[model samples]
Target chain A: MTDRNPMKDQVAIVGLGSTGFSREGGASSLSMALAAATEAITDAGLTAADIDGIVATNEPGASGPEAIAAGLGITEATHHTKPTPVAVFSLLDAARAVFTGAADHVLVVTPVVMGPWNSRRAAADPWRRGARSGILPVPEDATMAAAYAAWASRYIHEFGATKDPFARVAINSRTNAAANPLAAVDTPLSFGAYEAARMIREPLNIYDMDLPVDGADAFVLTSAERARSLPHTPVLIHAATSGIVGKNDEDQLDGLHRTGQHVVVDQLRRTSDIWIDDIDLFYPYEGFTIITLTWFENCGFCPPGEAERFLREHWNDDAQRIEIHGRIPVNTHGGSLSEGATRGTGHLREAVHQLRGTAGARQVDGARAALVTPGGFFFNPQGAVLRTAT
Target chain B: MNGNSEETDEETDDVLIARFAGNGITRDSADHFRGRLDRRLLMARCADCGRWQHPPRPMCPACWSWNMTMDEVSGRGTIHLLMVLHQGPPATGVDYSTGHPVVTVELEEQRALRFTSTVSDDFPAEDLAIGTAVEVEWIERDGTPMPVFRKAAS
Candidate 1:
């Protein structure tokens, strides 16, 4: 098989927009999604009709992409597709679509509404039901919780890392979120408060996980040479790369310090000669606290097993500084933990927001370069580096 | 499983029940189901593929060939990864919101099997490491056997 790296070539994000992050909102996922893309197009000084492709998250059939395109009054061209999940998936798809010459000036959108059901609301939305019910077909053992929990158990055994230190990640994320007006949880927190909050899993608590919100975020990327011509200040896609390892579905549970996310980072870093430390900002798709720790360490942000310590002293470091910023920044948009789950697309939109200097209160000053990494629990992950190529 | 012979419906909650196939898994996995009828834990070895297939399949996932059979594993592995959820055994009507930890064990056959149950009582409170030895167990959920693991026999 040939190694297909769709990240080659350069594209610029000239337009970006998103809806207010929330659950149980006034508009349908489609209408809310349309509003976001339209805003980005308008910001780019391009009429919605100029949009060539629609990259979308969290909708079924042709309804989601077509609806957004139709609402923008743009003709439905070759819109992209990924089984609706998160913002990062849409962003990655948009980049790939652009790379494939599938479309120029692509609009990436994510729409989430806390589904109207108990199980969907309480734990996670059901993907295993239809496939298992023979309503749809999928590979076996594809959606098993015990596999992940068991995998977490394996990480615990090998790394000597436990819940408490990881919980501090949640605390820090929430603390960062407090400064973000767009963040869902406006309430401030203390370490003691985090410790006092009722634990959900032994180590992962209610705070450690991201808030399940309903909304959409959108961005428009074009050729880098045309970036300045667009209405918004565009960020160039310097390099986009994706990787997977060892049937990544359960390989995270395979051995010590071995994870699919890490392999993807290593592959991208090795090929591009761009070390993780050179990254100005990180928009890691945050599903939980452990996810970030794994990325920070495995991506060469720090040596293995030092993620917690590095994060612990992040506030005190001068060498870790990126740009003139006081310290390296991760998830400046309140992240999935704080920003009400931009879904996967949120991570991409946030990266665009930072580069566009439109991230509002959470915008990191002098943020010229940024990295966006999106991952999947069932093992699909893609990462990109977005920078001010001007 | 929704009351069919082709697949088995294992209830994760009142609403969610995952499906298991006896159609394409390995003979060891097939026998594992047989052992399940007697409430025994089972896994498979894809000798050709040189890898273990959990929740096994008839064809080797690695080699993509049907030239594979089942063999009983020693049922020994390590607790390589874990996550303590703030939630519980799926939508159980319990006031205690301190959800149980979810664990994944790397089995002795060199495959990962997932389990969501209370951590073993003997486990430590802080600073846990990876690669701790594990012994598998079955948690009976409404008569269906849900596999869980504890730190190996010390």
Candidate 2:
């Protein structure tokens, strides 16, 4: 729980690129990775020769660092490794590499592809069918995606909450998605439509889960000294951390009070000077609606079990989205719920765009700081504070 | 209290691994699965400190002690977490069309110690609520003994 942060604002995200997202599922994970990786390198005003590091994420169907490097013609990389999925793990690894002089310019590429396990369309595709060859089908269980539903029931039982807060998370993302071209489902969601959505897991309907889509997001990281010459406003990494408790197994977790989210908030608050009140944009992961609600409570935006009321109070009725304190916009990029589950990469990319004043219609005016909390409570709960160079 | 008449206690490690192909059977957890064949719900308990753990581990998490034992539990607990799945992976007896109910129960032996399984068919779905008392009940799935839960007698 030390507040020591020597890396604070030392590394900057110099470039960002994305293949957007699509449910149509025509491209392979490798192609998407290459596409986004190349675009990101070009966006950073660098070439393959300049990238001496590669940090690829271990997404199920995605390519590894070796494959990505070979595809991009990066012949020599001193620092190349595959971190586990989710955006910040790779971001942190790349930032540390650049800071420690392992590489001057590091590229982080994360690709998400619909697999046969989650999507029926992907299951029907012959090429995707092979992806499940080694996997064994198990009986019904409350793990992984199902764990969220299990915990959501506990949250409702313990708090005596209605479905309003969960519905709001979906609707808010949908409303914001309408303005972002990168979003998959841009159709504005209404409270009635959310309530009427078919229930896939009890207490959580189809709308509650993130959509499985094909996409990739990539970022370029370099020391702050090198970022000053970049074209876009350098979004500095103030503090980044991933947290987890000992008994993190989905069903065995110590109730809602203490979780990885709490650990992350504790560490981030200690390391970063900017708190939630100072941020103009919020990107709490919405992989599950309940996750979004809990992040609000854990991050101290409001008291526990009061998200429904807090959201209702601060919700901008005219915009149909959350505007905390009538100013700070949440998930301005539509988030994983509507942005096709780039698995927190969309949240990171959107935050970078907004902080750089590049987000066309979705940008918050004069947005300077962003608080991005990505991943869920179990294994990958993570948080990072990004802001323009002070 | 053995669930199946055909299953014998002499099954080899290879045979046991083949039977529960996807249960993630490892040397540390093989004993737990072996107990399942005999209608026994065995959980790992630290021999040194008596700390209990589920989904067995090679060493005790609390004290890092190598001495551990697979001991039977009373299987009596209250439903701590509940999820009704309207869709899921294909299982022998699970009919997702009717919305399969899966629950993780907090065992009476220790707080926060839990085991996850489906409820027995006899337990009415309407009565399947969190905090309800439940006990282990054995049922056959694809000829393999499977442990489920049923509402405990008041």
Candidate 3:
């Protein structure tokens, strides 16, 4: 076992906690991050002092590692920052922290404002202040919509997929979100709701977008041996990998199909002992419906362009439609679409819930194995395979 | 901010700072020649390499020579790709969409030339194909003639 995968039987997340995901919530990054850290420490039956290591993710204008470390009163471990503000990057940061022997237990967290994206856009778009990039960015709102429009058009022109099939994803996510407390847009989404929307870019309508919200979320990851003594069941981070694929590896946002998550997941499935089909559920970090579809296809869960067809065939009203890939639940905590945006951190918490069986109303029965694929725009992807370590 | 931008009284189109791809330029100046269409020419001549460069740069990439001058070359290039955007408001106004033709015109002198202009609003999508011969048509916008593309007769 020692000679085998070092990460194996090494570290697992035993505790987790988060703060309210709000868009207009006035808490600064430090305030919300601290709030999340405090909750996780208490939940883990420890104190801020117990955490000698801190893994902090830097948001656009938020706290960097030094600030997050000082704020948490933690003096140790590695500090990492991603291009995006998503928490999924922080999850990997914690995994690295525990593996490196730099810290005993690591807490990963990120706090961000969410709400009508138009509002967040005003705050997030740095160029609005005349900080010129020389090259104009295709509008943020219009970018995904345009890509999807082009993709959907190509899919229609090539694979024979139509708008009706694509509508099922929005409906299903909403259906699942209705039960999730963290969900932001859990309303009655109908074909009418999807069709009546104006085209922001081609093919993608308003219904296909995600609501921005404000919030911070954190998860406590510790050694698997220590997790055995914890109060709650532990979900061991079996295999963790982050993938950066697409055009211009450093620049990101080049190729959507070959994202880091897809590459890592493919390697995991091929080399690891478990097949993707064996996984009990998936926590796909979704910012929109198209990203979800693309992940499903790119992960080899389904063939390219067949995501919509798979949903229609499998997601019957009587059946548990949320089990996205071959009956495995995807984003049971309502995903980014339903759950208030945690910038990828929310998905991490959802993975823990399913593993601990503490998911309550949204629990997946007999969920012993779970995978969290967290990502957003530009196809920057990271995935962690977690198992309930007895 | 004006209607048709092409019909505007501005002598030439504003130096369209257009898309900020953010990659720094790598060439130098050669000559500051004006367009044959008339008015305000901007070119670059590498201070070292004796080569004519447009879309002015501070140095010549090929010879690593700073001996470059800024000059205007005939804004003529062949169309690499052209698309008809039936949707979205015109770049210059709110109600009327540019029906503008955004062409990736490969410059006759340099490696690239791509600018936004309204060759036709109603050009069907099928009519536009790869390798269409096109030349620059400066539609006056603001104060400069905005670089646009027109069908170069085969």
Candidate 4:
């Protein structure tokens, strides 16, 4: 990767909004998107007319840019495109749009809905039944989400690991989630509770996977120069990148020794001046408990196969969450595991909140810099560093 | 081998696509599925570079050569990854109550070249462990041939 990152700290996320997250089946993806979009626009102290660019994510069942723009009553936009799901793809597009002057104010909206395939409550709803039409009637296979469980088995086999590390990840998110009203499952989780959870996929119980929920998270980004006048303290995008390698097919991966997570760490370390030693908070995606454990190892928080040991050493027993070096908290807004899956948008939004001193009860004291690594191993591994404007 | 007529071959292609529609059938991988009809496990191999790839790609990733062909693999390998699904998509002969085993095997033909499938019904569940030697076994699924793995004879 090239060291030429002129966009570093050039763009700032000045506004943030979320519809929270819930497993209850009541809202449509569009309605949630519009709700978050309007809230974000208001938070940014800007009217709809100020948004000249839109970057909507094509999350399953999510609305496109035109629908979102029309919903917000914005008539014209020069730069509007629908990037693939997950938060960073849309964030990168919007940030690049603002940095290059393609648009002065860009809105990145990501809405996630619990589809019929994943949730029984959704499957029973008539509106969500449409999502079941195109799903392939294939036999059981280890791909996509299943691939994580399949590989989790490999991790345990290779390292002789027990369920403690994965259970700690679950407990940590639950502990943090209790402080945030927006979180879905805020009930405190204990080792016994996690171990007792029914196995949806062996080696990975129900607690191991992210909760499928209906929610949306939106952000308003503009050039750092323009962000100074915004109502909230601007959270500057220090260095952002997505990483992948060839042969990324889930089952075809080159073992746990290397993955897209490794590539992301390599790139971020090279580009960002603020390394892990400088960050006050960490938000590694917990779409799967295994993903979070790997992030801990891949980010150099600990050596490979030592997450269980690292977590045990650094875990705050009273708080029931991980605080690296007893300072940098992991997933302070809970995570996909407990916060409901916004597919990393929640991580980005919480990072912004912490940096701006708006995280309320969960805010890190005098938080200045944060490391947010989102997405998973095979397809969508992404990382970004955010810091308060100087 | 009996249905070798050109007209029958054309019909067979359409039939194969429809039968394995859930496999994400494409021109690049159609031949690999066709091999399954004869109980043969075919993986893509580069004609120019001899590099092996799975889930069949049209061009060789190693050399970017379009000259690739589906060649039979010995189907003898060790399980590299395994997961027993307590719940999953519906399929014939799969009883979730007992749990279903899905594994990706590291083919003896090439390192890191893998294929994902279920294990045979009679395969001892307790014996299913990663690195266990296995060989392909054909079974009927929805009136079509499906390849699974069974513990290889020691």
What local distance difference test score does each model get?
0.59, 0.89, 0.59, 0.89
Clashes found in each candidate (C-alpha, N, C closer than 3 A): 56, 0, 63, 0
Candidates by TM-score, descending order: 4, 2, 1, 3
Model 1's CAPRI class is acceptable
In model 2, what is the error at residue A290, expressed in angstroms? 0.8
**Per-residue CA lDDT of candidate 2, range A39-67, in tens?**
99999999999999999988787788999
Model 1, which residues run further than 4 Å from truth? A1-9, A58-62, A116-156, A162-165, A271-274, A316-325, A376-378, B1-34, B47-50, B82-86, B89-103, B111-140, B145-154
TM-score list, all predictions: 0.79, 0.96, 0.73, 0.97
Please give, for residues B38-150, the per-residue lDDT of candidate 1 as tens digits: 55565555556666565555667777866654555565776455555544323222234543444455565554553222345455655233456767665554445545566
**Could you give candidate 4's per-residue lDDT for residues A1-390 as a string of tens digits?**
234788989999998889888988788889999999999999999999999999998788888999999999986898999998887888899999998899999999998888888889998989987784344456556678888999999999999999999999999999999988888888899999999998888889999998888888999999999999999999999999999888898889988999999999998988898888999999999989999999999999889999999999999999898988899899998899877878899999999999999999987889999999998999899999999987
Error of 2 at A140 (Å): 3.4
- Compare the candidates by DockQ and give the number of the best one: 4
Candidate 4: Cα lDDT at A32:
95
Question: What digit string (tens of lDDT, one per residue) describes model 1 on residues A22-126?
Answer: 654444567777777787788888876678888766443114666666678887577556444554456557777777788877887666654333124423434
- Candidate 1's C-alpha lDDT? 0.59
Better of 1 and 4 by lDDT: 4
True contacts kept of 2: 0.82
What lDDT tens digits, residue by residue, belong to model 4 across residues B1-154? 1122244466767888889888877767887888888889888898889999977877788999888887899999999998888888888888888888889999998889999999998998778999999999999998888889999999
CA lDDT, candidate 2, residue A49: 93
What are the C-alpha RMSDs, in order, of all predicted structures? 6.2, 3.2, 7.9, 2.4
